[model samples]
Target chain A: MYRAQVRVRYFEKKAYDLFLQNLVKGTSHLAIGQEAIAAGVAAALRPDDYVFATYRGHAHAILRGAPMAAVLAELLGRQSGLMAGKGGSMHLTYAAGNFLGSYAIVGAHLTIANGAAWSARYRGTDQVAVAFFGDGATNIGAFHEALNLAATWKLPVLFICENNLYMEYTPIATVTAVARPAADRASAYGLAPIVVDGNDADAVYEVALAAVARARSGEGPSLVEAVTYRHGGHSRADPGKYRPDEEVAEWLAKDPLPRYRERLLASGANPAVLDRIEAEAHDEVEQASLAAQGAPLADPAELERQVFADGGATWRR
Target chain B: MATLTQVATRTVTYREAVALGLAQEMGRDPTVVLIGEDVAAAGGVFKATAGLLERFGPERVRDTPISEQAILGAAMGAAMTGLRPVAELMFADFLSVAHDIVANQVAKARYMTNGQLSVPLVVRFGNGAGLRFGAQHSQSVESWLMAVPGLKVVVPSTPADVVGLLAAAVRDDDPVMFLEEKALYPMNGEVPSGEHVDQLGVARVRRHGKDATIVSLGTMVHRSLEAAAQLATEGVECEVVDLRSLVPLDVTTVAASVTKTGRMFTVEENPRLCGWGAELASIIGEECFYDLDAPVRRITSPHVPVPAAGSLEDAMLPSAERVADVVRRALG
Candidate 1:
């Protein structure tokens, strides 16, 4: 879990640098401080379990065992990326890894996740699907509709809301009516909603593991609201001036990586082991960045190939 | 070379033909599932899915809540993961609620996934504006959907065409919008029995003539045929073409007819500002400019919401007489 968090930090930093250099075009939403939830939730799931996440989902894809090189190549719009450069940062789907999709549209991913779970129930499979979104998505109509459908059908779905306290620049309190969004709506949908400190990766994994078991055992859906914070602005463009400096400092002190390192050290873990783990993650990310830098751009001639599967696409004269 | 083929046929309403087509596809393919409001026990609002729930059971035929976004979103997700889902929106006007899912998710997912994913999903909705169902319930929004690149739109006019085109839509490996004209559901015609799949993007020449060509789709096809018959009495031999498929439009067939007749008339139930009639007129002008003796003409609904009053609604929509008048103008 510590290695996963550190790798995400280093990977996103390089991505930000690449964006500054204009190597990576378009905006990217980075999950710098919210790595613990991604690592912990992913660790709790089986290999075949499906994951549908929001646009800020690089860490989720990486923790789900997507190759870093391909992910970096995707951000660089290279042909060898996860989506063959067609989907940049916002839209990524790793079919083999069971990372169904990372959609930019808020609350849209929830319905698709519910459908995956519904399909699983229809096919009589034990597979469970999870949808990861932010606090802002909870207020969307589709989110409530998905919850209602999942509860009524007893679908094997896990709704994960990483409540970072803010939706873009505005605080959750400003936009939402309820104080605890997920918990307040849980009873209306007749599903158990669990809230946890997202900074503590261990607590998140424990709760998520129990939820996964419940879903696989046909106990229906559950909502897990992990209270975390985003250390950066919504996108790379914003400077995060809207947030109070004191609040930012307080959250920075509660950074998950160093806290996890302290927990590992106090448990009498070898100091060299932690050092080597951190060094290896840095090396891996460095190698991935170099590989992505050398990757080739997508071919323009086949731009219309994937538009339709049957290959009947016609260009207008 | 010439060939003769014979197939068994029976007369049925457009509703029965559509329902039969769905049932046959469901029986043939296990992955095909029906999802919509009142599609299961109630058998759909228009009864287009009548008797399907009893045959397929509740598992395949699901009656979802009145949520268009969820319906379309779930269909997209299910289709991505090996299920060929045929979802229904109660009304074509309600497509606005499922707009993002249909346009952003369903249409773009295949291309965004770089061929790694295929959304073999079909969304069926009732279109056209002659029902006096008001502006919200009635609309011919095919032109709005055609602007979207990844979607294949089909407008079947007759009972036989509905059965054949719907079967083909379910089997097609892409997102297809099957727009059914609400007024034509009770209209009766002969449909071929057993398994039948019509080739999409192929326009059929309904009536052969020599003076002018009349291109139309959905309800307008019948109106064009009627107009052609009326023109025939006045020594104006008009060729009528039924465009069953809208996306991969059969420009070649329309061009051939226009070249032969040297005049063209395109009709649609949608408004004239930016309707499918304008597209047909442009295609004909671009492809058969030199072959045409006169400029192509378009007969379309007025640029206003369909009125609730029956008389006003009748006046707004294009009819056989209006189409014939346009043909006469094109000939002159």
Candidate 2:
């Protein structure tokens, strides 16, 4: 899990460097400080279990088994990208890994996740599906509707809300009605809610495992509100100066990478092993960046292709 | 005319035809399921999905919550994962609340996914205005979906066309917006009984003439035919074309008719500004400019929401009289 977290962090760092160099064309939402949730939650699911995530989904895609080279190539807008440079950073889908896709619109994937879970139930499969969204999505109508439908139909879905306390520039507390938005709303839909320190990978893994088990057993749906923080701006432009420095400093002290690193060392694990894992993660990210740079740009002819599965045969009169 | 009247033995109402198409497709493919609000116990507001619940059971026929977003979003996900879902909205006006799912997700999934995913979902809704259900319930929002690239907008005017087009939509691998004319739901007409299917992009020439070409779709197609019949008495000889599918617009048939007739008049139930009629008129102007003896004419509703009173709605909607007037002016 620590290795996965480090790999995500390293990938984001390289992506940030590429963005600075103007090689990465579009806007990317980095999961730098929030890597633990991706590493932990993804570790709990089986290969066949479907997964959905928000715009900040690089870590989720990587942890769900998307090749790092392809992911980086996607961010760089290359033909070798996961979506052949069409989706860019905001939308990434790896069907082979059962990572359905990610959505740029807030709260859009909740019902989609419910539908996937419903599909599994309809097909008589034991596979459960997970929807990873943000605290901001809880206020959207689709979120409420998804919970209601999931509970009413008893679908096998796990709703994971990454409570980073900020919906873009506005603090979530200012807009949200309750202290814990996801948990408070889960009760209205008759769903048992679980709250955990999202910065801790082990705790998130334990909670996610239980939720996945409950879903697999046909115990309806569950919501897990993970309280965490983002280390960077919402997108690539903003510096997140709106946040108070003292608060930022406080959260920085709880950075999951160093926190886990210290924990591993205090448990009497060899320092050389941790150093090697970190070095390997850095090398893997560096190699992925080099490969992405060498990848070819998407052909212009690709623009007219795949508008519809039938190539819009019926579309052209 | 004598043989045409005899061929009406297997006639059914427009609503029945739509139901038959859905039932037949569901019977043919186990993956086909109906999901919508009140589609199960209530049998839908216009009864377009009548008897489907009992015929297919609750597993295949589902009643979703009163959430358009969830309805379409779930349909998109289900389609990607292997189910051919026919999601219904109570009215076309409700599309405003769920346009994101249609425009962004369902429409762009296959293209954006680079062919890794195919959204074989159908969104069926009650379109156009005649019943005085007011602005919110009564609307012809088909123009809104025409701009979306990956979606196939199908508007069926007749019973035979409805069943055939709907079956084709269900079988297609792309997302389709099956817009059913609310006003024409009760009208009865003959439908081919066994294995009836209409190609998505083909246009049916209702009446062949040489003076002028009259193009329309949905309820407007019947109104255009009525106008054509009236114009025939005056020696105007108007050619009538029913464009069943909007996106896969059969401009070829319409162009051929315009080339023969030397005039074109497009009618639509939606507003004049940027409506489907405007698209047809512009395409005709671009492709068949030299063939026209006069400027292409467009007859459409005024740019306003459907009013509550029947009198106001009558004024807002296009009529056969209006189509006849436009055709006469174009012929001159």
Candidate 3:
């Protein structure tokens, strides 16, 4: 838990701050206030459970299982990065941990989540797949297609909408007729819809646990919408000007990392032990960034490789 | 060691031949699945996957909603996860609708994953004009896909070619864009039974003649073969090579044929400019230069949208007469 909390604590300081610090190679989208949702939902999942995320997936990749360094290395486009520099910030994969992938397309990952869940069901594994997207993605055609298919197929997918209030600079209110919360879309597909306080780690965790359990037990897919915030710009430029400053301050006050830390303290976690864990996670992130920077890249001639199959897995030709 | 007539090869329509290939693959591997709109009950628009849903249940033969993007996205998802998914986009023209997933996702997933992920997916569809689907539907965008780096573009003209290529695409690890000729579906040829695999990126010499080479693909291959037969009566023997895959282009066979024949007449149904024939012409000029006795002539459609009238459609396609005329010009 302390390991996860390092990113959590740093995120509360400022999303833009971490975005700046995590300047690997390209533009970065920091979750800032959105960190709680990953920590929250991640708390409810087993290490073997699968996760598929979107562009704003730094926190998800970290919380799911990828070391901060590897992700940072990936972001930096270093050869030693998670995707071996192939997938920058937008795409990341951890197959061994069942972290399916982090897609940049708005609502693309949900269908993949359905496929993964369907596979899990076919294999007779009790593992549940979670698809994380944003409120903006709710309006995309694929989101509707995925939900309708999942509901009909009864696949074990826990669709999580990180309602960060905006798709880029456009607020959900303007872009989506988010009649109720995004969770209400689930009812149209005959899936149970649940809304949670995304900032509260424990709150999100409990809902995720129940939803994932029901899904794995053949109860079918569920949709959970976590109402959260992104205190930083959507990408590298904007200061999140669309949302009012007062609303930002109000959410910052409810920052869950500190709140969750206080809860852990009150629940008997040692203060000195917490400090040691923070130091370790900090050091780990620094080391990963260095390692990724030093990793080797694909051969340039192979630049033209893998557009087609040379037969099987080998991209050498 | 003569391989005897133990296994009688069966002749089937280009449509049923592909259907047979997919069905055979599905029968052999439980993981091979098919998904598309009306592919289940309607048996595909051209009856390509006819009776497949009945043979394999809806779980294996899926009918996707009218969303082309969804069909491709789901197939990409299924391929990366575990299953070997073959998605049919009813018409090649509809590729524009799902351009994002195909251009960015399916094509780049493997390279982007740096070999960590594999999208063993096949997108099967029909292209080329002549049925009067009008401008919206009648598009031969083979060159567009051929330009994409990671995609393997296979345009099989006959039943046997479709059967063999479909089986190979189902088994290939990379994304295979398998294209069938919209005009040649009813054409029949012999196809082997059970898991038959046709090698990708190799041109098949349909006819062996020395006077000139007629390079063609899909329906044009049939046209070229017909032209060769007609030209035979005129004392002109034309060799025809059916290009199986466009991207991995069997340039070796093409170059060899161009080298042997000296004169070449390439035929195509797409607009004359930037068509696959234009590329093939350019390649022959570059590689098979010194051997050419005369300038390589090409039979192609005029640069315009496919007209609604049947007369115009007939004229737009590279007819046997047109191919024979071009071959005669090249032979001179």
- lDDT tens readout by residue for model 3, B1-332: 11134656777898888789898789998888899888999999888888999999888898878878778877887787788989999999989888777888888877776776788989988888888888878888787787665788889987877877888888888888998888888787877654567777778899999988889888888889999999999999889998878867888888888889898787887888888878888888987789998888878888888887899888788899888887776565
Report lDDT (CA) for all predictions: 0.88, 0.89, 0.79
Candidate 3: segments with Cα more than 4 A from true spot: A8-23, A179-181, A293-302, A305-317, B1-7, B193-195
lDDT of 2 at B300: 91
Candidate 1, superposed: residue stretches over 4 Å from native? A315-317, B1-5
Steric collisions counted per model: 0, 0, 3
DockQ for each of the predicted structures, in order? 0.59, 0.69, 0.43
Cα deviation at A211, candidate 3, in Å, is 1.8
When 2 and 3 are scored with lDDT, the better candidate is 2
What docking grade applies to model 2?
A: medium
Best by DockQ: 2
User: Where is the poorest 10-residue window by lDDT in model 3 chain A?
Assistant: A308-317
lDDT of 3 by residue, A1-317 (tens): 43575664453233344446764446667777776678877888888788899987777877777766677667766556777677787888777677778888888888878777776776568888899998888998889888888887788889899987877888777866655447778789987678999888788888988998899789898899998887677887677777788988998887766777788899999988877877776666666655655666534554554444552333211
Candidate 1 CAPRI grade: medium
Q: Which regions in candidate 2 have their CA more than 4 angstroms from the true location? A: A312-314, B1-9
Deviation (Å) of A52 in candidate 3 = 1.5
TM-score for all predictions?
A: 0.97, 0.97, 0.92
Candidate 3 A-chain TM-score: 0.89
What residue pairs are clashing in model 1?
Answer: none
User: Can you tell me the DockQ of model 3?
Assistant: 0.43
